[model samples]
Each structure stands twice: as C-alpha cells, then as structure tokens.
Target: MRPLLVVGGRELAARLRDGTALLVAVVAPIVLATLFGFALGGDDDPPLTATIGIVDDDGGQFPASVQREALQTEELRDVLTFAQYPDEAAAQAAVDSGAAGAAILFPAGFSDSVGEGNGGSVNVIESDESPLAGVVARSMVDRISSLVEARTYAVRASLEAGVPGDQVQEFVEANGAAGPSLTLADDPVSGGQVDLAMYYGSGMAAMFAFFVVGASARSLLVERRLGTLSRIRAAPIPGWTPVVGKMMVGFGLALVSMCATWLSSVLIFGITWGDPLGVFTLILGHAFAATMIIMLLASRAQTDSQADGYTLAVAFVFAFLGGSIVPVYNLPDFLQSLSLITPNGWISAGLTELAAGAGIGTVVVPALVLFGIGSVAGVLAALRLRKGLLS
Candidate 1:
C-alpha cells in the first residue's frame, strides 16, 4: 500500500508539472463552456416580436373580417404587429426593406370568389432576415383560411337543412367570430430552471473528464518507454502495484478536472448547480467511471500512440452518445435509450436533475449505476494489466 501511494503521488506530481495536462484538464473545458453559453441565447432574452404587412386589394367583408380577427387575437397580437399597405407592391417592398417580416395580400375579388363558394387564394411575401416571423405568419394565414372554409361548409349545410338564406349569413358570422374551442397552455414539470450556461457547462465538464483521465492512463506507456517501469520492477514492489498506482493517478486527475470545471462555471457564468452534496456524489461516480474506462482502453493498447488513438475515439464517442453534444431530450428515441449505458449520460442526467432542484437522493441511483460500471471496468483493467506485467 505504501509503495502504491508513493508511485501514485510521483505520477500525480509529474502530471501537475506538465503544462499540457493542466491546459486540457482545467483551461479548455471552462473556455468552451463560456463560449457555448454565450453563443446560445439565455433565459433573459426578450420575447420574439415581428411586424406583418397586410395588403387589402379586395377591400371587402371577408378580407376586412380576416384582418380584424387576426388583430383581435390576444396570442397573435403579442408576437405580431400589423401594418396596412396600399397594394401588393408596397407590401413586398415593406418585406424587402425589413419593415415587415411577412405580408398577406388579399387578391382583388377575393370576397366575391369566396361568396360564390369558390376558394380564394391569399399570397404571402416573406423576408429572409426573419424566418421565424415568416413561419408564424404562414400559420396564421392557414388558420384563418381553415376557419373560413369551415364556416362556408356550415352555412351550406344549414341552407340544405331548410334554414333561411338570410339566416345562413348570421350563422357564418356567429361561427367565424367565435374563438377556438381548445387552447394549449404550458405547464412545466421541474420546479427550477436550467439556462444554457448550466446545461453546456455540465456537458463540457463531463466530456473533458474523460480526457483528463485518459492522459493519466496513457502515461503508463510513457513510463514503460522511459524504462521507469523496469526500474520499479527491479524494486520489491509487486506487479499489480504499478497498475493500482496508475489507476489512482487517473482517478485523482478526473476528480480535479470535474471540481475545477464546476467552480469555474459558478464563478464565470453565475451558474448554480443545485445541491452541493449531489454534485459531489455525481463527480465522484463520474470520475471513477472515466478513470476505469480509460485504464481499460490503455491496458489493451501496445504503444503510447495506440493508446492516444483509443482515448480520443472512446472519449468522443462516449461524449456524443451521452448528450454532451446535444440534449438527451432532443435526441432521437433510440439514441436517448442508448445514452443510458454511458457514464457521461448518467452524469449529465444527474446534473440535470440537480439543476431542476432535485435533492441528493435523486442522484443516488445514477451514482450507483456509474459505480457499478466502474467496478466492472476496473476489474477487467486490473486483470489485463496483471497478465501483461507478469508476462
């Protein structure tokens, strides 16, 4: 045990003195988290608003009613402001000049065509600068058109059912003026909010923790090349002592990287990762998993270059599959399920729960699973290293 501790201490000190290790483990993750957090808009961003131009060529009841209905809708009014234009040309100009995000042109004789039971066509002009606004405008036009069609069908059916022709107009007006029967309202499940900063910060930390441990594990090959392992073998140390020492170094480095990233995120981005105890438990489980997985990969490689390649491949694959590059909720269903098997995924999920104001007990199951994965990998790595060293 003393020999293992000494070996681990020596390796850790060497890693600390190396500038590359410090840069990869501590500096790069923080910088990337900051850039990503800023690039993606935060919760404080103002709500989207756009102006829509309306060209009333028909100047008739249907077009007037459509405009009146859209303007009166409270939900649409919040995000959409209306501007009246004299003609299609002026509306197009408004869109081109960025004065309007989109335009709806009611063609001449539009009301006459609809009154004759022939559907009228409405032309829409959109601006390239405001695509989201254009989508909203398009949806609005489609909704109004559907409502008019429904009213026409209702009036036709009432007339066939022996209702007076004068009463058909009343029925159309009553139904057209009515609002939707059902509307959706948002009800969030989580008690707390997770902004872009907290999300990406946790993702970057989980992804980089693998690199931190990988570097330490790869150092075994470096020491072997330098005849350091041979010199150590000549001493009274056991064969497994060096392997345990290397594992210790990798595990220690992983923990340091995770903690540093957490601190940096809090200081720079003002991110609050809820429940300090939960965060620490997640970090411990994730660090252990990263260290053992990298140790297993390094133990299989014949050379330092091969180990480096393995480390890069495994780290990136795990990161991508584990929601480091994209949110798990946004991933395809198959990929979301696949993430459950990765240590990175477990850590990301734990962090997300924590950010949502879940207690430390919420992360216990994930932490246990991570520890289980690490234990299996650690056993395999130990066995493989023991065989190689004895041989």
Candidate 2:
C-alpha cells in the first residue's frame, strides 16, 4: 500500500509540472468563459423580453395609470411592449390564440380595491407555447402588484388613522413609484446572480475533461509499448499493486484538473455555482467516467498510435454532439434529443441547472447517470486490464 501510494503520488506531482496539462485544465476554461461572456453581452446586459397583452376592465384608474407610465418610463419602455385592450376577453383571447404570450387582465374592481386599501386578484393568462416569455410576464406582473400593494396599504392605513384624505393621498403619492417599474439590476435574479460566467465555465470544463483521457492514454499505453508493464509485473509486489497505483495516479490527476478549472471559474470569473454539493457531485462523476473510459479504450488498443487516435475520436465526437462547440439548444430537435445519450450533455445539463440556483434534488438525477457510466466502464476496464497485462 505504501509503495503504491508513493508511486501514485509521484505521478500526481509530475502532472502538476506539465505545462500543457495546466493549460487544458485552467487557462482554456477561463479564456472560453471570457469569450462567451463578451458574445452574450456584458455581465450587466438586459435579458430578452416579449410584448405582453394588457386588458383594462377596471372602473378606476390602475391599469390606465400603469400604461401611461409604461409609455413614459425608460425601464418599462425598453423591456415591455404593452398592447392595451378594452376588456379581459380580448386580452385572454390574444393569449389563447398565441397572438400574445401572456396577458394581464385588470379586474373591474382592481383600482377600486387600491382606493379601499384592499388587494385584488390579477388574472394572468400565460401561454404554454412560450414558457420563457410567460415567466418574464409573470415577474413583471409581480413587481407591479407589489408596487400597488405598497401604495394601497399605506393610503388605507393612513385614512384609518384619521389623517385627512387629501393629505394621505399626497403622502402616498410623494413616496410611492410614479408608476410600477422594473430594472436591469433585477433581471439576473430570475436565473442566478452570475449566469454568463457559469454557463461557459461548465461547458468548457466538461469539454476539457476529455483531455485528461489523452493524458491517461499517453501515460499507460506508452509505458506498455516500452515494455515497462512487463518489468513491473516481474516485481515481487502483489499482482494488483502496480495496476492500482497507475490507475489511481491517472484518475487522481483528472480530478485535480477538473477541480482546478471549477475553483478558478468561481474565484476569478465571479460565477456562483449554486449549491456546493450539486457542483461537486456532477464534477466528480464526470471526472471518474472520463478517466475510466479513456483507460479502457487505451488498454484495448494494441499500440500507442492506435490508442491516441481512439482517444481523440471519442473525445471530439462526444464534445461535438454534447454541445461543447455548438450549443445543443440551437441544434435541430432530433440532434438535441440525441445529446441525452452522451455524458457531456448530462454533465452540461446538470451544471446549467446549478447555475440557475438548483440544489441537490434537481441535480442528483444527472449525477446518478454519470455514476452508472463510471461504475460499469470501470468494471469492464479492470477485467480487460487484468487479461491484457497478466498475460
């Protein structure tokens, strides 16, 4: 055990000194994260929005007031294009027929409720055909509702406390929003605080995990081709000691490479990879699977050249189909469907969920898939390695 540990530890140290290894694991992820950040607009850029239908059925002035302000407010003007309707039926039909992704129907008593210091039920007709647009409309409605609540509750409380009606209106008007509003700063909260950095970082790291397989193939297959395996088999140590030591060395280095990428992305890029457990769980599974599969392929190849080619073929093909180079979401639906079979897609999907503030329950499914891949591949590799080497 001590001898194998020493051997494995030495290999880990040697990997630390390799410049190309460091570049793949650390520098490349940072560079790609930066590029994606730029292409997607800066960290502060506003997200996409849709034109939401607005139906003003109120006897009072709440819907009219919001529309008036929407025309004048710079923030609202930029994000929201509101098409006003006379009644709820028209607005609801727009959503139902897919003419509008979402609609906000202000009830007949909406403005009256505000004057009476009571809350009204806002009828939201959101479309299933445009889920993201529906979400944005819902958020907009929530902010507007909160503004109305603040003003209504304040005015009502003041009137009940015996303040003059005109005085209460003046006070409320002075402190409250000129109209309901939204801001660019509030947008990222819908996802997480740092989405851009985490998105690219996850893709880059998952793609680079395959590079460690290249390193593994070179380490093990080159040694075999040089007769080093036969020499080690001749040693007086237990039959499994040298094999376990070599496997440990390769797998440990792969873990370190991935961890270095993950940490640097968080520290330097300001990416908040939500849920500590979620982040590490997917990364650990991905690393183990990549390392094991690479070793298995390398063990099967008869020569160093064949192993190198095999490793590259598997890595690039997986990376392409999994969306490391091209986004899977942008691909045709059939191709996107196919990405589910690849570990790259599974890890990328789980990381994307983490970036969106998902926790253990949301990410455990992908981690389990990765674990299954690693376990099955590791068992097969072990069986094949014993025959390939002991013979």
Candidate 3:
C-alpha cells in the first residue's frame, strides 16, 4: 500500500512538474471553457437582438397603441431590434438581403378594425434565414393582438357600465397594459441555467479526459523504456502497485482538468452551476472512472503511437455515443439507450442530473456503476502486470 502511494505521489508530482502536462491538465480546459461559454452564450439570459422591418400598409390604420404594446414586451426589448418600413416590397428586399430578419405588413383596415372593435388579420412575413427573428415577429404580433383585445374588452366593460365613449377610450389607452405584455408561462423554476451548464461542462470534461489518456500512455511508455517496470517488479512490492499508481495519477489529472474547466466557466463567464458541492463530487468520481478505461488502453498498447491511436478511437467513439457533442435528448431513442455502454454516456447523464440540482444521493447509482468499471479494469490491469504482459 505504501509503495503504491509513494509511486502515485511521485507520478502526480512529476505531472505537476512537467509544463506540458500542467497546461493540458489545467490551463487548456480553462481556456476552452471560457471561450465556449462566452461565444455560445452560457446559461445567463441570452441578449435579445433581432432585426425587424415593419410596413404599415393600412394608411396609418395601425394604432400607435399596438406599436407601443409590442415594444413593451421584455422579449422585444432584449431579443429584437425593430426597424420600420414603408411597404412590403422594401421590407422583403431588406429581408432577402439579410438586413432585416422579419417584416410586418398591417392590412388596409387594421386600425379601423381595432378602433371599431372588429377582429382583422395582418401579414407577418419572416425571412426563412432567421428562425429566431421569425419567432420574435410572431411574438410581437401576439402581444399587439392580445393588448388590442384586452383594450376592446375594457372599452366594452365601460360601455356596459354606462361610461362615456371618450372616457372609456381614454381609460383603455392609459391603463390597458401597465405591466408586462408577455408572461413566460411554464418557465421552469431554475430557467435556462442548468441546461447550459450541464451540456458544456460535461462535454468539456469528456473531451479533456481523452487528452489524459495521451499523457497516461506516454508515462506508461517512459516506465517501460526506462526499466522502471522491471525494477518495480523485482522489488518486494505488489504486482498491482505500478498499475494502481498510474490509475491514481490519471484519475487525478482528469479531476484537475475538469475542475479547471468548470472554474473558468463559473468565474470568467459567470455561469451558475446548480450545486457546487454535488457537482464537484460528480465530476471527481466520473474522472476517476474514466481514468480506469484509459489505464486499460495504456496497458494494451505496446508503444506510445499505438496508445495514441487506441485512445483517440475510444474517446471519440464514446464521446459521440455518449452525447458529448449533442444532447441525449436530441438523439434517437435506440442510440440514446445504447449510449449507456460507454463511460462518457453515464458521466454526461450524471452531470446533467447534477446541473438540474440533484444531490450526491441522486448521483450515487451512476457513481457506483462507474466505480465498478474502475474496479474491473484495475483487476485486469493487475493481472496483466503480474504476468509481465503489459506492453
């Protein structure tokens, strides 16, 4: 036990002392996380910025009140940039050329219909190029329609109560929509926060874990070439000592890599991980498990190049199957179910749950499964090391 610990300690210290390993295990993940978080718009409320073109063909029939109501939506204020156009042709031209995202054309009788409490339709033309812009245009149209309907209701109420026409119109104009025009119903309690963190963080961790295999395989090659394995085998230490040492060091590197990635996400990009303590344990445990598979690959490869090929193949294959690049939610059912065979898949799932505010207790099952994998690999590596079969 002491020999294994001593060997593991030396390997950890050597990784720390090596500038390249330190960069890969720590600095690289941090940089990648920071870059991706900002560029991809990490879970913080996305800034609303869309270009819109408005063409009022109704000869000023579209009420100023409708426009005001449309502008009042927080989504419009944050996510959309509105531009008024005189006609559909010009708006179409702007949209075709990519200058505008969507166009609104108010029909000839639009204002009179609203003024007279009659329902009518307007043309909302959106550029197929920008789905979000189309959504924004539709949303603005809904807000305008709802506000007008609400005002119509208020006016009808006043008339029912024998209020004067002028007073009723004034009341509807003044107080119809004093608050938010859009209420985001069905908004999850936590909003977009968890989804964003889980996807990026888990993907980053899995990708970097692949990188650790390279370092571990290199260290294994060095041991073989320098006769370190021969010397360790000749000593009165357990055959498993070297394998355990390598596994421990690789696991620690994986943990450090993931931690650095998450830290950069939280601090630099202002990403909010749901629960820090639970997330930390989930990441650390998964890293340990991932290193087990990496150690097995290291044992199988006779040369650094062989290890490199196997590591790349395994990492990419598993990462893809496991939802590193795409969420499991988007995957086909069979593929999603099949992904469980890979460590990356389970790790990704566990992290997703953690980001959704699940505690360590919720993550325990996956953790145990991952540990079971590590134990199995460790036993295999120990057997191979004892027989001098590790190449």
Candidate 4:
C-alpha cells in the first residue's frame, strides 16, 4: 500500500511539474469562461431597453392624453423607448432593420372612434426575435385597450344617468378598481434562476472529467510501456496497490477541479449555489465516478489513442443526451427519459438540487448512486488488469 502511494505521488508530481498541465487545467478554463461570458451576452443582462417607433396616420389629431398615458405608464416607461415616425413604411423599415424593436400605427379617426365610445384598436407589429420587445408591445396594447374600455363604460354611465361628460370621467374614475395589479412575480424557483446556465456549467465539468481520468489511466499505460509495471509486479506490494494509488490521485485532482469550477461560478459569475455540504458531496461523488469510468474505458482500450477516442466519445455522448448542450426540458420525451442512464445526468440533477437549497441529506441518494457506479467501474478495471488483457 505504501509503495503504491509513493508511486501515485511520484506520478502526480511528474504531471503537475509540467508547466503545460497548469495551462491546460487552470488557465484554459478561465479563458474559456471569460470568452463564453462575452459571447453569450454579458454576465448581467443590460437593463431592459427597447426602441418603439410610432406612425400615426391620424394627421396629428390622435388623442394626446391617451397616447401620453400609454407611453408614460409605469410598465411602458421602464420597458420602451418611443420614437415618432413620419409614415408606416418608415416605421416598418426601422423595425425591420432592428433600429426599433416594435412599430405602432394609429390609423385615421383613431381619436374619433375613441371619442364616440366605440373603443378603437391600434396596430402593433414587433420583431419576433426580441422577446423583451414583444413583452413591452403586448403590455402597452393591453393598457391601451383597458383605457378605451374604461372610457366606453364611462360614456355608458353618462347616457344612463343623464350626467355631463365631465361627471362621466369622474364616474368611471370613482369606481374602477376590480382587476389585479401589474406586479410581476419575482420568485426565482418559478422565474429567475435561468436553467441554461446550469446545463452548460454541469456539461463543461463533465466533459473535462475525461481529461483527469484519461491522464491518470494513461499513466498506467506509460508505466507498462517503460517496464515500470513489471518492476512493480515483482515488488512486495499486492497487485491492486498501484490501482488504488492511481484512483486516489485521480479522485483528489477531480475534486479540486470541481471545487475550482463551483467557486468560480459563485464568486466571479455571481451564481448562488446553495448548501455547501450538499455541493461538496456531489462534487466528490462525481469525481470518483468520472475517474473510475475513465479508468474502466482505459482498461478496455487497446492503446493510448484508442483510450482517448473512447473516453471522448462516451463523455460527450453522455453530455449531449443528459441535457448538457440543450436543456433537458426542451428535449423530446424519449430522450429525456433516456437521460436517466447517464452519470452526467445524475450529477447535473444533484448539483441542481444543491443549488436549490438541498442539504447533504437531500443529496444522499445521488451521491450513493455515484459511489455505486464508481465501485462497479473500479472492480471491472481491476479484474481486467489482473487478467493481463489490458496490457
């Protein structure tokens, strides 16, 4: 056991001593994260801002009071940046060119229809790609519709009660308090905690696990090629000692990498990963499972190149099917169901549970599953190596 530990330590030290390993392990991930942050839109969403182009064919005679009310409302003010266009073609052009998020047109007699209590509708066309713009346009349209409805109701009351126009406005104003307020629900569980970020982060870690495990497994092949394995075999140590040593080293390195990624996301990216103990457990479990899986693949592969190819193919396939590339929810039902067989899927789910405030106790099942997988893979690898098939 002690000899194996010494051998494992020697192996780890040799790998770490290389300047290139540090570049690959630490610097590369940081650079990639920074690039991803830039390309995927800023880490923080730029404040909601939209350019709305308005074309009024109503000859400067549209209801100023209603238009002002629509533009200045609390909801629209925060979301829309309004600009007047001279004609429908110009407004449409602006929206099509992405200069404006949306275009609104008030047809001729817009005010006259509202004045007669007929409740006129304006046309709103928006660029389909801008979700924020669609939300703003829809909100503004709904508010305008409500205002027109309120005015029509006021006219009805005035005619019924024989009240003056001035008193009718007061009548509607006095008794218009029936609908729900426009407060948006701010619950993160239901709304704010974006799921894509979760998928990408988990996928990145899972993909990188191949490197750690592959490198450790490659160390064994290198030892055999160099006659070091024969020396170890002739030593007083048991046959499994070197295998245990490699597993320990690989597990430790995997854990460190997991911690680095989790801490980076929390501190630099402002992500809130909940329950430290739960996250730690998941990280450790995933590290062991990933390392064992790679070692098993290494044992089955015929050469270094074969091992590398096999590990890459397996890891990436798991990543893709387990909701690392596209969201699990967006996948077809069969694919989503099939994700259960993937270790990456379990790791992703366990991490999500930790992020959602689950404690170590809550993550016990997934952690156990990870440990079970690791145990099975490790046993299989050890048996294969003992049979001299891997050499």
Candidate 5:
C-alpha cells in the first residue's frame, strides 16, 4: 500500500513538473471556449424586447395606423417596445448609441406613395450586435406595409371599376386588416434557450479533462519501454501497484482540472453555475468516467503513438456525440439517447440546465449515468490490467 502511494505521488509530481497537463487542462479550455461563445452569438444575454426607434415622416395616417395595428397583434406585442423619433438621423443615432436595438425610418412620402397604389419602402437601421432581432423587426415592418398596400389596392380598384361611393366605402372598411394573417411567437418552452457561455465553458472543460490520458498512459507505456514494468512485475512491489498508481494519477488530475475549470468560469467570466454541491458531484462523476474510458484505451495500445492516436480519436468522437459541439436538446431523440451514454453529453446537459437557472438537483440523473459508465468501464479495465494487457 505504501508502494502504491509512492507510485501515485511520483506520477503526479512528474506530470506537474513537465507542464503539459497544466496547458491542456487550463489554458486550452479557456481560449477555445471563448471562441465558442463568440461563435454562438457573443454574450449569453437573451433578448427581452425589440426596442426600436421609429422615424415616421409619412405626414399621413399610415405610420400611425401601422403602430395602432401593431399594438393589436399579439405576436408583435410580445416583442415590440417602441421609442418614436422625428427623423431618420436621430433614429439611427439611437440605434448606434445603444438606445435602441433597432430603428425604422418611414420616408416623408411613404403614405402618399401607398395611397397612390405604389408600394413604399422604409429603412430599417439595426446594429450588427443584435442581427437576429433586427431581422425580425424588419419583417414586422414589411408585414404592416403589405397590409396598408392591400387596403390601397382595394380602394384603387373600387374607383377604377366605377363602384358607387357607399359600396367603395364599405370595401375600404372590410379590407383594413386583410391580405395575410400571421403570427410569430417564440416558443415559451422552459429551458429552451442555451446560454453560450455555459454551453462552451462546460463543454471545453469536460472535453479536455480526458487529456488526463496523455499523462497517465505515459507513466504506463514509458515503464514498459524501459523494461521497468517487467522488473516491477517480478519484484515484491506486486503486479498491480504500478497500474493502480498511474490510474490514480490520471483520475486525481482530471477531477482537479475539471473543478478548477468550472470555478474559473464562474469567477473570471461572472458566469453563474447553480448549486455548488450539485455541480461538484456531477463534475466528479464526469472526470471518473473520462479516466476510466482513457484507461481502457491506454490498455489496448502497444506504443506511445498508438495511445496518443486513440486518445485523439476517442476524444473527438466523444466530444461530437456528447453535445460538446452542439446542444443535445437540439439533437434528434435517437442521438440524444445515444449521447446519454457519453460523459460529455451528461456534463453538457447538466451545465445547460444549470445555466437556465435550474438548481443542481436537476442534474442528478446525468451525474449518476456518468458514474455508472465509469464503474462499468473501470471494471473492464481492471480485468484487462489483471491479464497484463497494457504492454
């Protein structure tokens, strides 16, 4: 038992001294996760309302009519929050200065043009920061403009076809909100939105945590190359001491690295991870699963290069399958079920739920799944080690 402890300590010290473990565990995750957060639409802030600046220079009722009708539209009501402006320049300034997320400018002749049976256009000025919301607002303007155009067309046809004045008046009244009736509302599904910061932060942390293999496998394969493995095998040190030591080294580093990564995300980025105790438990299970899987892979490899190849291949496949690259909720049902078998998926899902403001208790199932995977793999790896397969 003392010999096993000595072996574990030596493995740990050697890994820390070389610096590879630190780089892979700490620096790589932070950098890559920032890239992911940026790619997924920088800043994890979900939009509240389509705060828009309106420049209605139409000098007629159309602009007011559009706003009036927009208020009655339930879908638009969910998103539209307005600030009116007298001109395009002021409206654009509001958009640029962040006073408004988007801006709409109706030209002076807009109503007149529509009234004359000519379609009119409005300029939608939006910041690049809120591209999705800007586009949605622009579509809203297009819809309102179409409704106005349809009303105008009906009036024009009535006059041209020699319809009586009373009948033409009736025509205008009946077609006011006509043309196309549509609704656009975001699905209010709870936890439907994935916060980019948490998504990538948790993903990169779990994905790189598996690099514990690079160090652990080195301890095993290096001993074999130097014939230390056979010497230890024949000595009173016991056949399994060296293997246990190396596995301990990998498991300890992985758990520590994952915990550190998760903590750093909260402290440095001001990211919120709910329920500290629950998060710790889940992270521990994820690390355990990662270590066991890596151990098994290391057991099958003959040389350092083969071990490295196996690590990279397994890591990438696990990352892809486990929701490291995409949210599992966004995946098809079959894929989501398959991902449950991977540690990456479990950790990712747990983090995503926490990010949505659920307490840590919500993640118990995933953590338990991870623990089960680790236990099964750990058993299989132990059997292989007993058969002297790591050589």
Candidate 6:
C-alpha cells in the first residue's frame, strides 16, 4: 500500500508539472463554456416583441371581442402590439412591409354567417421573415373562432329547448361574454431556470474530463517508452503497484479538472449549478468513470502515440453521443437512448437536473450507474494491465 501511494504521488506530481496537461484539463473547458454562453445570449437581453395587424371588415362583435380579450390581454400586452388596418389590402401591405409580423382579416358579414350557424372564414396573413409571429396570430384567431362556435352551439340548443325566439339573442350574448371553462396555468417543477450557459458549461466540463484522465492513464506508456518502467520494475514493488498508482493519478486529475471547471463556471460566468451536494456527487461519479474508461483504453494500446489516438477517438465519440455537444432533449429518440450508455450522458443529465432545482436525491441513480460502469471497466483494465504491462 505504501509503495502504491508513493508511485501514485510521484505520477501526480509529474502531471501537475506538465503545462499541456494543466491547460487541457483546467483551462480549456471553462474558456469554451464562456464562449458558448455568450453566443447563446445573456439573461439581460430584452423580451420578445411582435406586431399584429387587425382588419375588421365585418365591424362585428366577434372581431371586437378578439381585439378586447385575446390581443389586448394584460399577459400578452408586453410581447404583442396591435394595429388596426382599414382594409385587407392595407393589412397585407403592413405584413409585407414589415410594419406588422402578421395580420388577421375578418371578411364582411362574418358575424352574420356565424350567427346563422354557417361557419365564417377568417384569413391570416403572415410575414415571411417572422414565422413565429404568424403562429401566434393564428393561435389567437383560432381561440376566438372556438369561442364563437361554442356560443353558436349554445344558442341553437336554447332555441331547441322551447325558449322563445325573442330571448335567443340574449342567450347568444350571455354565452359569448362567458369565456372558456378550462384555462391553462403554468406550474414550474423547479425554482431555478437552467440557462444555456450552465448547460454548455457542465457539458464542456464532462467532455474534457475524459481527456484529463486519459492523459494521466497514457503516462504509463510514456514511462514505458522512456525505459522508466524497467527501472521501476527492478525495485521491490509488486507488479500491480505501478498500475494501481497510475489509476490513482488518473482519478485525482479527473476530480481536479471537474472541480476547477465548476468553480470557473460559477465565479466567471455567474452560472448557478444548484444543490451543492448533488453537483459534487455527480462530479465524483463521472471522474471515477472517466478514469476507469481511459485506463481501459490505454491498457489496450502498444505505444504512447497509439494511446493518445485511442483517447482522442473515445473522448470525441463519448462527447458527441453524450449530450456534451448537442443537447439530449433536441436529439432524435434513438440517439437519446444511446446516450445512456456513456458516462458523459449520465453526468450531464444529473447536472441538468440539479440546474433545474432538483434535490440531491435526484442524482443518486446517476451516480450509482456511473460507479457501476467504472467498477466494470476498472476490473477489465486491471486484468489487461496485469497481462500486458506487468508481464
């Protein structure tokens, strides 16, 4: 145990002295995360705003109701503005000239048609440059149309139920005044909103952790090439002692890289990771997994160059497949399932949950899975090292 610790300490000291190792492990992730965060827009940016044109040819209650209730609602006032156009041609011109993102044209006699139980046509004109604005306009018109339809149905039902003909207009007006029974309310699951900065920061950290540990593990090949391993073998140390020591160095470097990235992300970028315990647990698990996998890959290589190649290949594969490059939520369903196979995926998910205000308990499953994967890879790496390096 003493020999193993001495060997591990020596390797760790050597790694700390390597300028390239420090840059790749400690500096690169935070720098890239800052760039990504700024590219995605900051929290200080203004809210979205769009203009919608209104063309009411019918001059009826339905169009008036839409203008009063849907377009001018307090909730939408900050994001949407309305302009009244004299005719459909003027509204279309407004949309084409970019004065308005979209337009709603209520055709002549539209209310009469709706009142007569004949569905009326409502035309929506959308700007080519602002498609989302058009979508919002269309949704608003659709909601008004639904309300009109509901009132028409209620009027027809009252007439059929033996109500006097003179009272039917009263029923229509009353039903139209009453809004839809079911209204949607927002219920956020977590207190903290996970911004783009935190997401890419965590992902960059997870992806680079592989390279950090890989460099440490590949040092075995470096020592072998320099004939240092031969001299070390002549000592009274056991064959497995050097391998265990390298593994320790790899694990230690992995933790350092992850923690450094985390600190930089918070202090420099002002990104909140949420739930300190959860973040640490995820970091520990991912570091263990990264070290084990890099060790396994390094064990299969014959030379330092070959080990570097293997490390680069595996690091990129895991990074791409894992949500480190593209978010898992945006990926296709099949690819999302494939992410579960990588340690990067597990850590990214756990960190994401934490960012979204989840408790420490939420990360337990991910941490356990990471540990399980590391254990399996560690066993395989030990066996391979014993057969190849120890021999």
Q: Which stretches of candidate 5 lie over 4 Å from their true place?
A: 38-194, 329-334
Per residue, candidate 1 scores C-alpha lDDT tens digits across 194-265 of 556777777888888888888877788888888888888888988777778877877776788788888877
Candidates 2 and 4 compared: the better one by TM-score is: 2
Tell me how many residue pairs clash in candidate 3: 4
Ranking by TM-score: 6, 1, 5, 2, 4, 3
> Which prediction has the highest lDDT against the true structure?
6
| Model 2 Cα lDDT, one tens digit per residue, 52-145 | 7887778577676655665565644555577777777888788888777788887788776776567676778877665444655666577668
Error of 2 at 1 (Å): 1.3
What is the descending lDDT order? Answer: 6, 1, 5, 2, 3, 4
TM-score of 2: 0.63
User: lDDT score, residue 325, model 5?
Assistant: 73
What are the TM-scores, per candidate, against the unseen true structure?
Answer: 0.65, 0.63, 0.60, 0.61, 0.63, 0.67
Q: Taking the tens digit of each residue's C-alpha lDDT, what string does model 4 give over 307-374?
A: 77887788778877766555454456699787767777777777766665556676788889888888
Runs in model 3 lying further than 4 Å from the true structure: 43-198, 359-361, 389-391
Decoy 5 TM-score against native: 0.63
How much is 340 displaced in model 6, in angstroms?
Answer: 1.2
Please give the RMSD of candidate 5 to the true structure: 9.6
Candidate 5 lDDT, tens digit per residue, 228-308?
888777777777888888888888878777777777666656766667887888888898898999888877778877888
By TM-score, the better pick of 3 and 5 is 5
Best by TM-score: 6
The candidate 5 region of ten consecutive residues with least summed lDDT is: 183-192
Error of 4 at 239 (Å): 1.6
Query: What ranges in model 6 sit over 4 Å off?
Result: 46-192
